[model samples]
Target: MTWNCGNLSSKLATEEEYKIYVDGSYLDGKIGYGLVVLKDDKVIDELSGYVSDPDAQDSRQVGGELVATKEAIRWCQSRGIKRVAIYYDLDNIKKWATGEYKTRKPLTQNFKEFIDSTNIKISWHKVKAHTGVKWNERADELAKAGANSQGATKKNGLVDDLEEKAKKFSDYLQRRGYSVNYKGIYNSQAAKLSLDDGFQDIGHLNIYNTKKLHLVPKYHELRDKSKQSELEELWQEFLG
Candidate 1:
């Protein structure tokens, strides 16, 4: 669960702002990063990368976080975006941004230099991990997918497709006049299961169940179920 109830419908206060959430995943000896960019609460883009160097002195977790953070800023820069809001679960990274923490390691130095060189004005947000935040959870999924990646030729299509579908579904919800929380809907369902209870292991059960949960009548009343019949068909087609 990477989302919470309080922030489900949260939106950026200004039009010039872009929200970016970054997360890192370390599995076995591999490391990866997840980067998400959003505008007006709609996902505009995302990226993930795997770091193959296990011999690096810095831990994979730190390396992934640093790389994701640096690249996120670079992404904003490339887009000519000057006002950006960055969210991460790592406290050390937040502290480093605020001048409350410092390190002399080459990796850290390089990251710091990159930040100083960037002209973007960034607002930093520190969020609790695994609390059901939509973009944050998406980043976590991407990072895990990256960690599991074998190489350029072995990219994971399933994860990527699921992510894209989820974003499109979220957009659909917005268009349908529903302020749905993509990750929170799944978490709300998962919370109902008793501890130690095991259900059929659907691939990416969260995404699957979230779709099912929304298709019913209880979640929210549709503005026009008849008008949305076509959307329902498209949705089912994608899921199938």
Candidate 2:
């Protein structure tokens, strides 16, 4: 089989086929992925790892998902297995592999090409996330653990300076009565920030390598129109 997208069937796979449950996690801006391989409903192997590639970092959890799936496929290939089923929480995993979604991003394009290069029979199944599905939940737990396992490496001067500025910006927003959350190091040079007004999210701020900042607003048009000027003022003040 090339690929099948939908819910898993009640029937179990044969002895020759393997079932792999995969999940990706993004924690504090670190991306990680986990996978559990099963044969006849018994665990055969488990894999988890942190993704450090800059391209994967930009894709976040989706990057982890694709990595997990690809790793699982490689594992099967190494063992001479030709048929496998992949269970995943994200729809994009299936969409990208099946050509249902365009692979505009570099990470996605690479993922699609990797899948095309493989000769194994792969089937994709969507599993509802955080619903306590046994293998699926295990994959999620492993993914989180992998994300937490990212090593503490020393940063360069530019990164250090950018992190300091991001912290100051967060503190400034908090002093102004807005809730500020930091997403740690987004990459080697940037960090992600989230802004909220107690009950609703205002937008995300990206602190870049050049010390420039950009806001991605999530506020509703009509309801947040009055607050636009205030946000602009905050941005100016932060830059100033």
> Which candidate number maximizes TM-score?
2
User: Candidate 2 on 57-157: residue-level lDDT in tens?
Assistant: 88779988987997787677557688888899998888899899999988888677667756578877788999989999999988888788666323365
Clash totals in order: 8, 0
The best candidate by lDDT is 2
Residue 49, model 1, lDDT: 74
lDDT of 1 by residue, 1-240 (tens): 011112331443253357899998888877888899888778999998775433322576787787678668757644657777788888788666545689667666656555554546676777889999888899999888877774662454444444435544543433333332333223333211001102221111134334444432221233333434554564566456
Clashes of 2: 0
- Residue 193 error, candidate 2, Å: 41
Give candidate 2 misplaced runs (Cα > 4 Å): 6-16, 152-240
